[model samples]
Target: MPKCYWLGWSGQFEYLERAKQRLALVVPLTLALIFLLLYLNFRRLTETLIVMLSLPFAMVGGIWLMWFMGFNLSVAVAVGFIALAGVAAETGVIMLIYLDHALEEARTAARESGRSLTRADLHSAIMVGAVERVRPKMMTVVAITAGLMPILWADGTGSEVMQRIAVPMIGGMVSSTLLTLIVIPAVYGSVKGWRMGRGPLREGAPERMAA
Candidate 1:
């Protein structure tokens, strides 16, 4: 046989290598931008951290589903995760919005009555805010799942890539919704309650919380 010659990468592998390099850079940048936006929105490190917690909750399902489906880490899967992060953050924002409103309303009522904010008041506010949001959040998850289901089941050309993208979103949305509805309220209440217990509620306290 003639002497073999070496050549540089070509085809999909070349594209994959490029994607891996870009992904390494992009993921950290994306996370930093997200943190900045969260901080800007809440104006307090505590509340920003609370909202950031949703990312882990979202990741749990995405990773689990990818493993279950026997999918490897590809550019498509990474894209799915990025998309999932966005939706998770959005749901977290919504939760924070409702919680802030309820808490502020309770604070106003307590101030009018000339009494300190009570644990009972916090419980009531959490319940009202969390319960009222269930329908909308479920609807969002359901709609997303429905749209992705087709792509997941398809076996035609490009189905593999599409399915990888859809799987993470579908799985992440379910877990994210549950956590957003349940965990977020509990955490927000705990944080706010801690703040309340530390001292008398200052007039500016509400402004510090995520609204």
Candidate 2:
């Protein structure tokens, strides 16, 4: 008898194996490019990091949905995840922009009043940015969800693959929107307040030196 060897996986498994290879290569490159664009947009590591924080939370929902739906890892799913990352990052950027605008306003107010920036000012800025202007962020998630919901229920031609693409996006939008509204604001406030707190110390250092 001759010994037999299994040369490669066949059918779906073969496709899956190849997809895994491509996904591993493509996902990281996609993320690196996203972060590069983010860094370029904000031009500050702190802000860029705050934006980057949303990506993981965004993935949380996609992974959960995929597991719940019994969907195995495949090319369509990977594409959905890639799309999710971009949208998640976009939402984060929008939230950050609002917060930055509010903070800039606060800074202008403080300068006009001849007072130093304070934690209270930062807190108020966050509230104004995240809470008051929340509709736009919510609308974004709603719009995406509404658009994809039909695909989930779609039948006949191409629906299966389309649903795979839509599922991650719908789930990710929910989680990412929540993060953009609630978590990002809190984190942004804390980071900005800490920087503001150190400002006084640095300013006072010159006085101490003069004394």
lDDT of 1 by residue, 64-177 (tens): 999999999999999999989988987888788788778788879998999888889888988998998898898999999999999988998999999999999998987898
Off by over 4 Å in 1: 1-11, 203-211
Lowest summed-lDDT stretch of 10 residues in model 2? 202-211
TM-score of each model, paired residue for residue: 0.89, 0.89
Which lDDT tens digits does candidate 2 get at residues 71-181?
876799989999999999887887887777777787778879999878888788789988755898878888889989999889998999998998899888878877888
- CA deviation > 4 Å runs, candidate 2: 1-8, 200-211
What are the lDDT scores of the predictions, listed in order? 0.86, 0.81
| lDDT against true structure, model 2 | 0.81
Residue pairs that clash (backbone atoms under 3 angstroms), model 2: none
